[model samples]
Target: MNRISMVAVLIAGVMPFTVGCATKKYTREQAAPIINKTNELDDLTAKNSRDIKDTDRRAQSGIADAQAKATTADQHAVQAGQQADAANKNATQVNGQVASLAGTVENLDNYKPVAESSVHFGFDKADLTKKAKDALDQLGGQFSSTKHFIIEVEGSTDSTGDADYNYQLSKRRADAVIQYLADKYQIPAHKIYLIGLGKDKPVEKNATSEGRAKNRRVDVRLMTNTGDQQQNASANTPQGGK
Candidate 1:
């Protein structure tokens, strides 16, 4: 050994030791930063997962609440609809009853006479016969018992005369009956309404003498009172005058 060879050998051995120490230091520093970053990321991920689970729970609760409210609302609507239908049905029934009452009132107000007796007239004359006068006198007695009385003296004639002449003659016959009742029984003239149907409503055939005599007659109709008719109708009803 020379001096230069000894120096080179020692330097080479020392350089290897220094290189190994530097490599170990660098590996430790890099591994520490990586581990810290990984831990931070894991914490953030756990927090986000918990938040998502809480949001899902809140959403489920909201859905349940909404469903309950909807069910209650549906039930209320059904009840309201049923009540309204019942009210409408009741109104319809009331309207029908009112209409029926109105119709009955109208019918009573417009009541006309129904024929109860008849009087025969002469062949061509409108004069009152003795038999006719007797019949009229009997009818006049019934007027005092009635609430309202109207003597509808409707005269009819035989088919032998002309239509115009017969109508006039029938009118004269009704007038004569009214006058006779007024003069004999002191009945008011306004109580009687004279009408002449002529041969329009002949009760018998016009070809025979007996039929002609039958046709030439006056109908004395006695009308029932509105109260009486109403009472009759009420008697026939199910509610019995309610």
Candidate 2:
């Protein structure tokens, strides 16, 4: 009776241990699948984060490029404004000179031509030659002893080009002569009366090349109010004869 009872107890204990080992193996298999799925989700989250950072960097780069372009455009606009202002200032100076000359012409009748000279130029040229400068030097030499005098600078061009173009060319020629006189002799601007007549006041016939060349010239005349002053002095003096 004691041997049969001991064998029964041994069989019951072995059966309970086998059931516990099977339950532990099933729990490990389920937990392994859940952990693999969680790892896959973490990898996906990391990839998404990298993509977001790259996109943000690209957006910032684009914004910076746009700002750089805007700054360049603003710089170009400022440069253009400065160039325009400079051109306007040059035009204003030319206009003022023309106005001053016009005012001097009003009292032209009081003056008489005392000395005169002609300066010739090449075809479509406004530059003064050596001969032209020498002629001007001779003309200006009289100014040292002269008093109450004014200079008349009359510019004319050949009838070769358009009327408008000829007018501008004549003006350029006159300016060249005036510049030389003012620079070398230090002649004041107020003492000079300037005009551009173009082909309208040509000194020679435009039929020949020589004549046309002669026509492209500037006539500078030194005039004085000395005669008017003398007449005024005589009129103001006491006279014995009526």
Candidate 3:
């Protein structure tokens, strides 16, 4: 209603507005660096989070690959061990077979014969006559119980034939005798020793037919040591060494 009171009211209202403006200005100025730093920190935090996720993913993949490689290595080692065991077993079997063969060879080396003789054959014939068979049978009977023995069959041919033909014929005769002994007596194959002398060592003259017939013959030699002969004589008594 008065002039002084109106003035005072106007100053009070204006003063409040001015103070509010100053306070807002001060707050804006003070908060400017803080806002900028907060924005930068947010960006760095986001980048660090992505980097951690990527590292975790890579680590998991590496672990998976390592486990797979280890499994494969274990399987391969098992297979190699099996192969080694098979090789060792095969080696043992082969060694056993070799030992058996060596034993057979030793038995052949220790063999001794009981009785032997010579028998004549016709020219160019590889067969044995009835008389020749009979003689061989008698010789074989001398060693009835013996399981191992050596029979050396030496074949000779007459001079009536060519040298080469006589040699071949002598070989055939020797082979025939060996085969007969093997088939009839069930003798082991390693026990017999056959040789063809052809006309090299003729027991009779080759000029006459009778002498030539005698030359074309097979001579069987019985192997014997002094001790073996003595034992054979004791067993055979009057029959002697046949």
Candidate 4:
């Protein structure tokens, strides 16, 4: 055989193996970018999941803070409402007291003494006898028919006890008479003035039994603004309570 033919045979034998190596290198080059891209995408997905978890935690914390503020506001509202109610009640009471004071002031100069009566009592007692009730019944009837009339009741006691004790006993006697007149005649309590003289203003001497009985008496004086006898009795006695 010639030398050229022998060289050609040697080249043919190695060509298939060289082509196979080149094909494998080309395929590996093409797949390298796809593998790197897949790794980058996996890392980005893990970071996104961590960020989403952090955002959820912050949102829950904000919700809890808002709920605490809402609870505080509700408690403050209840306290304010209760305080407002208390203030309103105080204002109403003050207004009523002012009105009553005004009414008393307006009627100061329009009344005068017109008539009087008396009821006697036993020693150291507040209960009324039959004679006392009969006297009060007579006065009550006359006063009921009159217009704008007020009664002043003065009570006294015999000088047999301490002054303080006598004073309180005298007051009890006056109150007993006042209550009877009010209940029996339906007279308003505002029109009556009550006073306790104790042993101070005695109409009789204190040494004798008859004089002490006269001292232990309740004197009731009726006064009126209506004036038929105003010119006849102009020096009307002043009514006072102590």
For lDDT, the strongest prediction is 2
Per-residue CA lDDT of model 1 for 15-94, tens digit only, reads 99999999999999989999999999999999999999999999999999999999999999999999999999988987
Candidate 4 structure quality by residue, lDDT tens digits, 133-226: 9998888878766886778899999999899999999999999999999999987766788999999999999999999999998999887867
Count of clashing residue pairs in every prediction: 0, 0, 0, 0
TM-score of 2: 0.57
lDDT of 2 at 190: 74
RMSD of each: 19.6, 6.9, 12.8, 11.7
Clashes by residue pair, model 1: none
TM-score of 1: 0.48
Query: Which candidate number maximizes TM-score?
Result: 2
lDDT of 4 at 218: 95
Instruction: Assess each prediction's global lDDT (C-alpha) against the native.
Output: 0.82, 0.92, 0.81, 0.87
Instruction: Give the runs in model 3 whose Cα sits over 4 Å from its true position.
Output: 1-114, 225-242
Tens-digit per-residue lDDT, 14-70, candidate 3? 998999999999999999989999999999999999999999999999999999999
lDDT digits (tens) for residues 17-99 of candidate 2: 99999999999999999999999999999999999999999999999999999999999999999999999998898788777
The better-scoring model by TM-score among 3 and 4 is 4
Measured against the true structure, the TM-scores of the candidates, in listed sequence, are 0.48, 0.57, 0.48, 0.53
Misplaced by over 4 Å in model 2 are 1-105, 240-242
Single out the weakest 10-residue window by summed lDDT for candidate 3: 142-151
